[model samples]
Target: MLNGERLTGTGRSKLTAALALAFLGAVTSVSGTSAQSAVPKPGASVFTTDIAPILQAKCEACHRAGSSAPMSLRTYEETRPWARSIKARVSRREMPPWHIDKTVGIQHFKNDISLSDQQIEKIVSWIDAGAPRGDPNDMPPAREWGNGEQWNIGEPDLVVMSPKRVVPAHGPDWWGDLEVDPQLTEDRWIQAIETKPVGVARRVVHHAGTTLIQPDGARESLSEFAVGKYGDIYPEGAGRLLRAGSKISFGVHFHSVGEELPVVIEVGYKLYPRGYVPKHKVTEVNVGVINGHLFDDLDIPANSVTRHEAFAKLEKAARIISYQPHMHIRGKAMTMDAIYPNGQAQTLSSVDRFDFNWHVAYVYDDDYAPLLPAGTILHTVGIHDNTAANRLNPDPNQWVGFGNRTFDDMLQCHVLLYYMDDAEYQQQVAERQAKKKSQTTQNQ
Candidate 1:
C-alpha cells in the first residue's frame, strides 16, 4: 500500500494544462478516423447487423444503467449521444478499461474484459459510417445486469462489512482503516474472496487491501482489490488459513471526485468445508522497496525522464502467481527482473505504458508461473516522465517524492507468491532469522 504520510513533492497548476492537452489530443485522433473518405460508409443496416451486437456483448456490462460507467449504452438512444466519444475511446483502445499489454507479460487472465483490435475496428467503422440507429430488433436481448445484491460467484460462507464512512466532496485524499470481527470460533480455509463497494464508493474508491489482525497485534494480508479487479480464487490445492479470534481490517484509499460519497465496503469469503485442509499455503508479499529513501528521492528535472531501482532478496524458493506495478500519473514504465545469486537475470513482467486509471494485476497461467529459488533478488525499475509531453503530468517542473497523494509518486512492485507447504514456509522463516543473526554478529 502507498503511504501518503511520506509524501514529499511540490504542487503546481501546470499539470492541469497537460491534462487539457491530453483530452484534446484524444478527441482529435479519434475524429481523424471518422474523416477517412476512402473508407466506405456502411449504413444503418450495417450497424443493425454488426455494431449493436458488439456493444451488447462487450460494452454493456459496465456502460449499462446503474453501473459504474457514467452513462448507459444499453440502447440506441442511450448510446447515440456518445457516438464520437465511443469511437474515440475504442479507437485508442482505452475503453473496456483493461490495461494489460497483451503482447508482453502473461496474457491469460480469467477476468479480462479487453476489446479485441477487431472489435475496436468494428466500432470505429460504424462511427465513420455515421453511427446509425440500428434496428431495435437486431439488438441483442438486454442483459440482466447484477445490482450488487448477489455475488458473481455463488454466495460466500462468511461476509464482513465496514461501517459507513462519508467521503468529503472536496478534500485531500484519505485512507481509512476499518476494523471488523468475523467472530469465528474455529479455524477456516478461504477458497475464494471478494470485496464489493456499496453505493457511490464504487466510483471514488481507488484501492483496498484486507488484513487479518491477531490478538497479539500482528497482522497479515487476507486479500487486496484494485479498480476493475475481480475477487481472487486460489488454486484447488492452495488456500489461505484463518485462525479463530482474528479480526479483519480494510485499508481503503479514497479519491474525491467533486461530490460527497458514502462508502461501506463489504468483503465476502468462500470457505472450504470444516475438515478440509489445503495442500499449499497461499500468501502475498511486497517484494520491492516502497516509500523508502531511495524511492522518495524521485526528482525528475523538467523535460527529463527519471529512473529508479529497488531490490528485494528472497529467503525462500517460491512460485510467483501474479504481479501489479504501482505508480502515479507520471509513471511511464515499470519492470520486475529476477536476478539469481549466480548473476543470471530474467524479466518477470514489464508494463511499457502505465495508465493511472487502469491498474491490473497480471496473473500468470498455471503453466507459466515463475519459480524463483532462494537467494534470488527481485529488482524493480520504474521510469517516470515529468516533461510537458506527458499528458497526465500534473506539474513537470515540480519535484516529486514518495507520497500517498496522487501528485506525489511511488514505485511498488507488488507480487504474490506461495510456498509449496508448511514445512517450506517454516524453513524459509528459519533461514531468514539465521541470516539476520549472522549479519548482526558480523556488525558487532
Candidate 2:
C-alpha cells in the first residue's frame, strides 16, 4: 500500500491543477450499431478520391511500406478489401492512434494523425454516397517524411540495453522478459523516458515497462518475471527508481506476431527539473481485479454485455486530483463517481463507448474538482464484450484474469491522486533519482 497520508485542502486544490492530462482522448467509444452505421461498400468512389486523402494525410505514415502495421493501404486496390476494417476501427475511433483528450482543450504532437468527428463523418458519408473521387486535382500533396532519429529534446544522458532473447521460426508468439543494468553516470532528475530495440530484430520484441529496486537503488526486473507479480494494485512499486549510481534492470516483453528472430533493446530517459518547485506528488491508479467482490474474477458472458464495479474509499481529508480508466478490446464503456459519506456524489468519467486500444489517463481541471470527506467511495463502472467483434479477444468464448502478462483479462479501476504534504514522498523520489544519476555517471 502507498503512504496514504491525507492531503491538505490547499494541497488538494493546487495538486489537482498541477496534475494536468498526459494523453489524448482521441478515440471515442461506439456501440456495435453505431459502428455498422459508419461503413460503406466499394461502390463509394469518394472513399478512393476524397477519403484516400484523409488516410494519406493522417494514417499512411505508420500504416504504409515497412511499418509495423498489420497491413498496407497503399492504393485503392489494397484498401478496397479492408473497407469494413477501416470503417470499424475508424467508427470506433481506433485509427490514427492518438490517446490525448480532444473533448476539452489539450496540446497535440506535430505529426498527430488523429481524426475529428467531422473527419470521421466525412469519410463515412463519402463511402455511403458512392465515394466520388472528386477529381485528381483535388488530391492534397503527399506528406513528406522528416528524419525521426532526432530526440524530442536532445541526446539522452544514459542508455540501457538488454540481453538478446531468441525466437523460434514460425510458431506461436513468445512471451518473455529480459533484464538490463544501466549504471548511471551521475545523480540526475529525469522528466521523460523512451525505449527502443538495440539491433535489427524485427520479428521479436513489443513494448516494455520497469520498476526500480527499493532502497538499494537497483532496478527490479518486474514486467519480465511471470511468477512474482509485484502487485496488481495501482500506485504499487512497479516503477524503476532513478538516482545517481542506480542500476536499472528493465523488464522487456515481446510478441511473435507469427515471426521468429532474436531481439535486444535500449531504454532511454530524459531529465528535466528547472521549471517549478515539485511539491504535490502525481501518480497513476491502475484498475484491475474485478467483479461482485474484491480480488475476484468477473463472470462475464461471451457475445454479451457485463458491467463491473469497484470502489476506493477515501479518507475524510482526501480529495481526488485526477482520474483515468483502462481496459482492453473487450471494454465497452466506463464511468467513475465520487460518493461522499454524506451521500453526495460527483461524476468523474462518463464515457459512452470504451476502446481498449484507446484507453488513457484522464486528468481533470481543478476549477470544478470534487472533494470527499471520509467514506468517499471512488466508484468505477465498466461494460465489456467478449463477442467475435473484439479483435483482441483471444477466445471470445473464454474468460481471462487481472494479473499483468497481458494474456488474462482485467475488470478493475484505479484513482491516481496528488495530495498535500507529499513532500516526503517527493523527497524519496528525488533521492532515488539522485542515485540513478550517480550510477549513470560512474558507468560512463
Candidate 3:
C-alpha cells in the first residue's frame, strides 16, 4: 500500500470499488441486528473476522516488514501481543497518524487513512475481550508489499547513491552533506523521488533530503524523506525542475541511539523526459519572519503556550496544492488561511494537534484545491507548548527560540503551489472584481 501518495487517478477508483464491496458485505452481516443493539462480543473469532480487516486496511501498510513501523503486525501471532498497545493508540486517535483537524475546514482528502470511531470501538472491545485468535480461515487475504528495497512509485529514471558514513557512539546528533553526481545529459522535470536507507543505518537516520548543489555552494531542496512520509510525490501534471550537471547532495541528519553505526543511503528520482513541459510548475514557499518580530522570532516562554503568525502575499495568482507544518519538539498546533484582496478569509489547512514525528504534507483534493488571486495573502498561525506536559520537550525550565538543533524550536509553514501565467492571472483578477461589484449592487 502506498501510504503517502495523492489519492486520485486509478487509485481512488480502486479504493471506491473495494469500499463498495466492503459495505455490501457489512450490510449482510447486520441485516437482523438493530441499529442500537449491544456491541458485538469480542473474541478470537471476532479478531479473525472483524478486527483483522481493520488492521489490514489501516495499520498494516507501515506495520509490516521492511517498513518504518517498529513492529510487524502481519499475522495474528504477531499482533496478539500488541493488542493493548494498538487499542491505546487508536483510542487516542494516534495510530493512523493523520494530524489535520477534520472539522475546521474542507472535509475531503484523498489520502486520509484514519480509522473511524466505530473501528476504534471494535478494536478496543476486541482487546478487552482477550484478543483471541479464533481461526486462521477468517483472516482477510494477505496484502502484498513493495518489492524488496524497491520504490513504491515503481522504477525511477535515475538513482544516486550517497557515500557510506559512520555514526559515532555516544556523540551529539550529526548533520553531514554528501554530494553525488547524477550525470544527467540534459535537464529533466522530476515527478517523484524517494530516499532509502540501506543496511543498519535506517535505525538512526532522522531525515534526508536531496538538494541541487549550485556552483557557488548554495543548495536548494528538491525532495525529502522522514519518519512518516514515504517520499515526495507531486499531483497530476505537476513537477519540479532539475537542471543538467547539477550534483545531488543528501542533507542527512542522524541522531545517535547510544551506539556506533555505519550506513549507506540512496535517492531515486522518477522524471518526465526532456522537453516535457508540465502543466503546473510546482514550488514550495516557507513563510516566516525570524528577525525578532513577534510573528517570526518564535519565542516560547517556559510553562506557557505561545502563538505566532506570518504572512506571504502572492505576486501571481496560484493554485494552492498542499501544506506541510514543520517543528522540532514542543510544537502544538498550526493553522493556515488565505485572505483574498476583497477581505474574505478562508482556512486552507489546520492541524489542531501537531506531532513532530508524524509529519506529512496535507494535499488538497483536485476539486477542493483553492485558487488565490495575485494579491491574496497567505497567513499562517503556529502554536507551541513549552510546558512540562510536552513529553518531547528537552527542558521545560528554559525558554525556546528558533534554531536548527533539536532542543531549540522552529515554526515553519511550507506551502506548495503552482503559479498561473500572466494572462490567466489577469483574467482571474478581473473576474473577482466583477463578482465583488455584483455582490455590492445586490446588497444595495
Candidate 4:
C-alpha cells in the first residue's frame, strides 16, 4: 500500500471510490447543497474580494505570464477556465508546493507560500459558485512582475557565468566541474545568492552545486540550483563570506535530451555593504549517512516500502536556519528530529508528502528556528515506495538502488547551521524565553 491506499485488484477499486466520494462531498459542501451546514459560508464576492487577493499574494508570483507555472491567474478571464482545477489542487494542498506537515514540528517559516485553510475554502467556494466575476470594479489591481530573466534577489552586486558546455542529443549523463573567476578585488559578505541555468541549459541540466575556492585553497559550498529550489537568502545579521581572489567552481550534472543543447550557468550574488560584518556566518551541512555514501547499504526489494535513517551530531551549539530534503523519484516522506543533550527528543520538521520535483528549502522563522546545544544529534528518517502505487515510479518490478541517473534513488537532507559559542547560545535562549513570556502575557 502507498499513502494508505492499496494499488492492486479490489484495493484499487476501493481507493477510487473513496476519492470520488471525497471530491463530490467537497463540491457539495462548497455549493451549499449538502445537508451538513458545517461548511464555511461562501465569501461575499469571492473571486474579486477574497480569492483574487489570495492569488495575488501567493500564486501570481509564479502563476503569472512568463513565469515558471504553466498557466496565468492574473485576471478573471484568464483564471476562469482553471477555477475547478485550482480548487482541486488547493483542496489537496498540492499547489503552492509547500509540503511541510502542519501537525508536527516547527510551524513558523519566513518563506512559506502555502495557502491558509480560509484561503483554500474561499477558492473552493468561488469555483462552486460558478466562478462568477462578482464585480468588475471589485477586482484588485493586477500585480506587477519583472520579465522572465529578472533576478529573484533583486539586482546582484556581482554576476558570474560558468564556461559554456555542450550536451549531445543522446548519450549517458555527464558530470564535471566548470570553474570561473569572479575577479573580486576584496573580500565581501554575501547576503543572498542565486544560481540558474541560462537559456537552453535549463532543459538538460539536472543540478549544479557551486563551491567557493579561496586564495588560501580553502573550499566552501556557495549555492546550488535544482528543480524546486529558488535560491538562498541568509537570515538577518547572518551572511557567508566570499573572499577576494576566490574562484567559483560548479559541479554540474547534465543529462541528454532529445536535441543537442549548449548550456551555461549564471551565478548572482547580493553582497552586504562595504566593511559590514555579519553577526553570524551561515554554514551548510548535509545531514545524512555518516559515510556520506547516501545509498551504500541500500537494498530495496521490488514492490515494497522501505525506510532508512541517518544521524549527525553537533559538536557545538548551533541555530538551524533551514531544512531541505533531497531524494530521487521514489522518495515518499522524510522527517528530521533533534535529540538534545538532556535526552529530550523533538521533531524539527516533517514533510509527510515528499515531492521530488520541488526540493523546497523551508527557512525557519527567526523566533521558531531550532536552537540545538552541543552534542545534539540530528536524526533523519526517509521513506521510499517502490511499488506501482507510486505514480512517479518508473518500474515497480525492478529492484532499485542508488545511482547518478534519475531512474535511481537516493536520500539526503540539507541543513544550514550557524555555530555559536556557549555564551552566545545562552543569550539567544534567554531572549527567546523573554519574548515568549511577553507574548503569553499579552494574550492573557
Give the true-structure RMSD of model 4.
6.7
Ranking by lDDT: 4, 3, 1, 2
lDDT string for model 3 (356-416, tens) is 7555677777556677888889888899999977756778889888887777888878787
Using all chains and alpha carbons, the TM-scores for the candidates as numbered come to 0.76, 0.60, 0.78, 0.80
Best TM-score among the predictions, by candidate number: 4
Clashing pairs in 1: 4-404, 15-394
- For model 2 the local lDDT of residue 146 reads 43
Please write out the lDDT profile of model 1 over residues 275-354, one tens digit for every residue. Answer: 89987778766654442636446666676799988888777777787787878888888888899879999887777778
Q: How much lDDT does each candidate structure score? A: 0.71, 0.51, 0.73, 0.78
Q: Candidate 2, after superposition: displacement of residue 182 in Å?
A: 1.8
Q: Given candidate 3, what's the lDDT at residue 228?
A: 45
Instruction: Report backbone clashes per prediction.
Output: 2, 56, 3, 0
Regions of candidate 4 where Cα sits further than 4 Å from its true position: 1-45, 148-154, 164-187, 196-221, 224-231, 243-265, 272-279, 290-295
Q: Write the per-residue lDDT of candidate 2 for residues 242-341, one digit (tens) a residue.
A: 5556655555545554456666655556544434334433343444453245366555665666788876665433434444455655776667777767
Q: Highest lDDT among the candidates is held by which one? A: 4
Worst 10 residues of 1 by lDDT: 1-10
